[model samples]
Target: MTAAEAARQVAKHPIQARNPIQVLGRSALSAVRMVGGVGVFAVRGTIAALSPPWFFNQLLRQFVAIGFFSLPVVGLTAIFTGAALALNIYTGGGRFNAEQVMPQIVALGITRELGPVLAALMLAGRVSAAIAAEIGAMRATEQIDAMRTLSTDPFRYLVGPRLLAGVLMLPLLTVVADTIGVSGGWLVATRVLDFSSAVYIRNTVDFLQGWDILSGLIKAAVFGFIVALMGCYHGYNAKGGARGVGRATTHAVVSSAILIFASDYLLTTFFTHAAK
Candidate 1:
C-alpha cells in the first residue's frame, strides 16, 4: 500500500520472474550434460565389447537371461496385439466394405511396426530394470571396485556381455513376435470373424515383403542397444546407496522406453524413404 512497499514488491517481482528463467536454463544444461555422458559411456562400452580378452561365460549367461527368459511375455504380447489389431482393422474396413484387407493389413502391421516396438518396450521394462538394479547393487556394495582391484575391467566383464546379448537377442525375439502375432491375427480372423484360415494365411504370406520383416529386425537390434546402454549407463554411475540403485532402475526403464519410441520413428522414416 505504501510507495516503499510497492517499490520493493516491483523489484521482487522481477527477481521472481528471473528465477524461472534461471531454472529453465539449468535444466537445459543438465539435459545436455546427461546426453553427452550417455554418449561417452556408450562409446566406452562399445570399445570394451570389441576388444580382446572376451568373457564367453558371462555372455552366455546374459543370452539366457535376456533372450530365453523373455520369450513368454513377448509371445503373449504379440498374440494379443495381433488379435486386437485384426479386430480393429476388420471393423474399420467394414465401413467401406473392404474387410477382406484384414489379413494383408494385419501381417504388414505386425511385421513392420507393432512386433518390434512392443517386444522392445517389454524388454525395456523387464530386462533394462533388471540390468540397472543388478549393476547398481554391485556398485553400491563396492563389488565393481573389487573387480577393478582384481584387474578385471568392469565394462569388459559386465557391460560388454550384456550389450552383446541384447543386440543379438532382440532380433530373435522380434522374429518370434512377428510369427506369433500373425498367427494370432489368423486365429482371430478365422474363429471370430469367419474368415477362411487357408485364405488368410495365403494372403498374409503373399502380401508381406522381405523388406518389411528386415526393417523390423533392424529396429529390434537398435532398440536392444538402447535398452542395454541406458541400463549400464545409469547403473555404472549410480551414487548414494539403496536409494541410488532404485533411482537408477527407474531411470533406466524410463529412458529406454523414450529412446525406443524416438528411434522407432527415425528408423521408420529412413526405411520408408529407402524403400521408395
Candidate 2:
C-alpha cells in the first residue's frame, strides 16, 4: 500500500478503536452526573423539610400513603418470604442433620437481611413508580411551574414530604415486615417442618439480639431515602412529554432497586464491622 493509504488506514483504526472508549466514557460521565443530581435533590429536599413554614398536613398525608397503605403488600411479601426461607433452610439443614437450627437461622436471616431488603425492594417498585409518575405528570403538565408562580415552593410542598415520609415510614414498615416474616417462619416450621412452635419461638428469641433488628431498621431507613430520592430526582428532571414521564417512572424504579441492593450491602458490611 501507498504510504498515505497506510497512514489513513492506521488513523481509521485508531478512530474506530477510540469510539467505544468515548461511548463508555460518556456513559460513565452520565452516570456520575445522574448520581450528583440525585444527591443535590436529596440535599435540597432535606433542607426544605427542616425550614420554617412546614406543611404538616402534606407530610401526614404522605405518611399515610407511604406507610399505612403499603402495609398489606409489605406484610404479604414478608410472610411469603419468611415461609419460603424457612422451608429452604430446613431442607438444607436436614442434609447436614442440622435441621433444628433452622429457627434461629430464619430469625437471623429475616431480621438482619431479608426483612429490610425485601420490604425496601417492594416499596421501590410500588412507591417509587407512583412518586415518579405523579411528579412527572405534574412536570409534564407544568403544574409544578404553576405552583412556583403561586408562591409555593415545590420542593417543600412536594419533595420534602415524600422524603420525610420515606425515612420515617420505611423503618416502621420494615418492623412490621420483620414481625410477619418471623411469624411466618415459625408457622411453617411448626406445621410443615414438624418443629415445635414453642421451641422455634424460644430459639429465635434466644438467638436474635437487639442490634440485629436495629441494623435492619437502619438499613430500611436508608433504602427508603434512596427510593424517594430517586423517584423525585427522575420526576423533577423529566422532559419531553408522556414518553418522558414514562421513562422517568421506569428510571425511578430501576434506580431505586439498584440503590437498595447497593446500600444494603454497604449497611450490612458496616453493621458486621460494628458488631465486631
Candidate 3:
C-alpha cells in the first residue's frame, strides 16, 4: 500500500521463495551421504567376506536362519499373490472376452516382478528387523567391542557371513516363490475361475522364458543384499541402549523396504529397455 512497505514485502517474498530450495538442497545432500555410507559398508563387507578365515559354520547357520526358516512365509505370500493376480486378471480380461489370457498374464506377472519383489519385502520386514535387533543388542552389551579387543574382526565374524548368505539364498527362495505362485494361478484358474487346468498350464509354460525367471532371481539377489546391508548398517552403528536398538530395527526395515522398491523400479526399467 505504501512505497517502503511494498519494497520490503517484495524482498521478503524472494527470501521465502529461497527457503524451499535451501531445504531441498540439504535433503539431497543428506541422501547422497547416506548412499555413500551404504556403499562403503558394502565394500568393507565384501572384502571381509572374500578374505575370510572362512566362517563356514557361521555361514551355514545364517543359511538356515535366512533361507530355510523363510520358506513358509515366502510360499504363503506367493500363493496368495498369484491367486489374487489370476482372479484380477481374469476379471479384467472377461470384460474384453479374453479371459483365456489369464494364465499367461499371471505367469509373467509373478515370474518377472511380483514374486521376487514381494518375497524380498516380506523378508525385509522379518530378516532386516531381526538382524538389526540382534546386532544392536550386541552393540549395547559391548560384545562387539569385546570381540574387537580380542583381535576378532567383527566385519568378518558378524557381517560377512550374513551378507553372503543373503546374496546366495534369496534366489533359491525366489525360485520356490515362482513355482508356488504359478501353481496358485493354476489352481485358481481351474477351480475358482472355471478354466481347464491343462490349458492354463500349457499357456503359462508357453509364455514363460529363461530370461523372465533369471531376471527375477537377479532382482532377488540384489534385494537380499539391500536387506542385509541396511540391517547390519543400522545395527552396527546404533548407540544408546534399548531405545537405540528399537530405533535401529525400525530404520532397518523401513530403509530396506524403500530401497527394495526403488531398486526394483530401476532394475525393471533396465530390463525393459534391454528387452526392447
Candidate 4:
C-alpha cells in the first residue's frame, strides 16, 4: 500500500485520548446490568427453591452432596494451607520477636476468612464448570426441551439440585477447612516453630470467637450460591455446539472465581463496619 493509504488505515483505528473514558463508561453500564440480571435470577430461583416438595428434596440432596462429599478435598487443602501459613508467619514475625503471634494469627486468619473463601473457590472451579458444561450440552442437544415436553421444569429438575447443594455444602466444607487448617497450624507451630502444643491451642482458642466462625460460614454460603448460579446461568444459556458448551464452562469458572474475590471485599467491608 502507498504511504497515504497506510496512514489513512492507521487513522481509522487511531487511539483517541477519550477512548479510555468511553470504554470505562461502557464497562460500568455493562456491569450494572449484569449485576441486576444475576440478582433477579438468584432471587427468583431462591423463591422457587423455597416452594413445596421441590425445596425439601433439593435441600436434602444438596446437603449430602455439598457438605458430606466435599469433606476430604477441603480438609486436605486446609491442612496444607494452615501449615504453610504458620511457617510463613513465624518466619516473618521472628524478625520483630513476635513469633508468639503465629498460632493465634494463623487460627484467626484461616478460620475467619481464608479457609472458607479458598475452599469455595476450589469447589466453584470443580463444580461450576462441570455443571455448566453438562447443562450447556443438554441445552445444545435439545435435552432440556425434551424435559419440558415431559412436563418437567428444567430449573426445578436441574438447576435446583445443584444450587441447593452448593449453597448448603459450602458452609460445611468451610468448617472442615477451618478445623483441618487449625490442626495443621498446630502441628507446624509445635514441631517446627518450637511452640508448645498447649500454648498454641490456648492462643488459637482464645483469639478466635463465635463471630469469626460465623463470618466465615456466611462467606461460604455466599460463595456457594454465586458459584452455582454462575454455572447454571452460563450453561443454561450456552450457544453453538460442543465448542459453545466448553466456552460456557470456561466462562462459568472464570466468572465465578472473579465474583468470589469481588464479593469477598464487599463481605469484609460489611463485617468490618458491623464490628465497628
Candidate 1 local lDDT, 109-225, one digit each (tens): 999999999999999999999999999999999999999999999999999988988999999999999999999999999999999989999999999999999999999999999
Off by over 4 Å in 3: 1-29
**Per-residue alpha-carbon lDDT of model 3 for 1-276, expressed as tens digits?**
875564455455645535665456555665787889989999999898788497899899999999999999999999999999999998899899989889989999999899999889988998999999999999999999999999989999889998998888889999999999999988888998889878988888998999999999999999999998899999998899999999999999999999999999999999999999
Off-target runs (Cα >4 Å) in candidate 2 are 1-18
For lDDT, candidate 2 versus 4, the one ahead is: 2
What lDDT does candidate 3 reach at residue 252?
98
In model 4, pairs of residues that clash are 62-165
Candidates in order, TM-scores: namely: 0.93, 0.92, 0.90, 0.86
Which tens-of-lDDT digit does each residue in 164-271 have in candidate 4? Answer: 788878988898899999999999888887888888888888888899999999999999999999998889889999999999999999999999999999999999
TM-score for candidate 4, residues paired by index:
0.86
| Steric collisions counted per model | 0, 0, 0, 1
Tell me model 1's lDDT, rounded to 2 decimals.
Answer: 0.93
lDDT of each: 0.93, 0.90, 0.90, 0.84
The top-ranked prediction according to TM-score is 1
After superposing candidate 1, which stretches have Cα over 4 Å from the reference? 1-18
lDDT of 3: 0.90
